[model samples]
Target: MSVLLPPYAEALGVVAERDDNGRLVLAMDFAAHVRGRPGFLHGGAIAGLLELAAIATVQDRLGSDDRPRFKPITVTTDFMRGGRDKRTYAAAVISRLGSRLANVESFAWQESEDTPIAAARLNFLLARATGSPNR
Candidate 1:
């Protein structure tokens, strides 16, 4: 299935691909627009990537038939390290998915998966698709 990302994500040069484990991996290329300080990535850009990854993960889980509507409740982000000038990758996992809510966690890393530059925990309120029996 094709994954649809927002306009902002496209502006940031973010692209989606499947990892070895067959999970969605979102990548953002470092550029002047995403730069901060001398050569580090902007925190906001990193957070945005995490947020998008989280939403995509939830959407993947819900599938096309369900077509669930998502309302973001909150996102807690932790900056683990300074993101250097390079391509950064993020992947999210659904911690919990229920009829009314979803909990997701995403992490961004550059050189190594063991070393993450940032991480975020996201909570979303899910509304069942209109005309769906569950709705």
Candidate 2:
């Protein structure tokens, strides 16, 4: 089945892929749709990228138990540096997981490990999957 996307993610052109170990890696390119300035990515777009990556990471870890639904109850994003107009990579790790709630943290970088782009914390409501996928 195809992966699902959140509303803001769809607007900013977020893409999700499963790695060899079945982990989800969400990525976004700095395009006109998400450019804050001439070449920098918008802050909101960067947040969306981080948030979606975190959510998808939680979903992947939870397995197919409940159809994989995630709603952000709270999202705190720390904008460290400006996201350059390049292919951005997002990686997320689950901080805590519960039956009804999950907390995830993620980071986005331009290329090198030292060049941090953005960091975020997200709270997700784990329930039955809902809504339609973004097409």
Candidate 3:
């Protein structure tokens, strides 16, 4: 399926592709726009990528027909290490998807999955699409 990312995501050069496990992965290339403090990535950019990954994951799970409108309730992020100037990747795992809410966890890494640079836990309020089947 084709994923239509938001304008900001496009502007940031974020792309969605499947991993070896057939799961969606969001990737961003390091550039001046996302650079910070010489060679590191800006914190805001990393957080944005994480948020987008979470949203994309939820959308993928819901499918186009049953897709719901999402409103972010809260996002708690932890920075483990500085993001270096390189290709950064992020992916989200849906912890829970209820009738009206979703809990998602996302992580961003540069070199390897074992070494994540940042992580975020996000809670979102989901509104069922009009005329859609009830969950």
Candidate 4:
């Protein structure tokens, strides 16, 4: 399956591709635009990447036919380590996709998924159709 990123994600240089194991991966290369502190990435950039990854995962799961508007209710991010000067990759797991809410966990890593530089947990409020159950 393929994913389409939002314009902000595109402007941030986020790309979606498959890893060697065929697992979907979202990545962004190191560039001056994302650089900070001389050789590290800005925390906000990494956070933005994490957010986009979560959104992408949710979008892919919902598919085009079931496009329900969703808004973030909460976003919590943990900076495990500073992002170095290299490409960063992110992937998200949806913990719950309920009738009116969704919970997603996203991680950003550089070399391996085992060692994540950052992680985010986000809760979203989903807006369903008029006749759909909100419960």
User: Tens digit of lDDT per residue, candidate 4, span 1-120?
Assistant: 568777988888999987787666799999988887889998889999999988888878887777677688899999998899899999999999887788999999998889999999
Candidate 4, TM-score vs. the true structure?
0.90
lDDT of 1: 0.89
Model 3 CA deviation exceeding 4 Å by range: 129-135
The digit string of per-residue lDDT tens for model 1 on 51-113 reads: 989988788777776667777888999999999989999999899998888999999999999
Supply every candidate's count of residue pairs whose N, Cα or C atoms clash at under 3 angstroms.
Answer: 0, 0, 0, 0
Q: Rate the local accuracy (lDDT) of all candidates.
A: 0.89, 0.80, 0.92, 0.88
What TM-score do all the candidates reach, one by one?
0.92, 0.81, 0.93, 0.90
Q: Is candidate 1 or candidate 3 better by lDDT?
A: 3
- Residue-level lDDT of model 3, residues 29-106, one tens digit each, is 999998878999999999999999999999999888777777899999999999997999999999999878899999
Lowest-scoring 10 consecutive residues by lDDT in candidate 4?
126-135
Location of the lowest summed lDDT over 10 successive residues in candidate 2: 126-135
Over 4 Å off, model 1 = 129-135
Q: Indicate which candidate wins on TM-score.
A: 3
Ranking by TM-score: 3, 1, 4, 2
Stretches of model 4 off by over 4 angstroms after superposition: 20-22, 129-135
- In candidate 3, the residue pairs with backbone N, CA or C atoms under 3 Å apart (3 or more residues apart, or in different chains) clash, namely none
Tell me model 4's lDDT, rounded to 2 decimals: 0.88
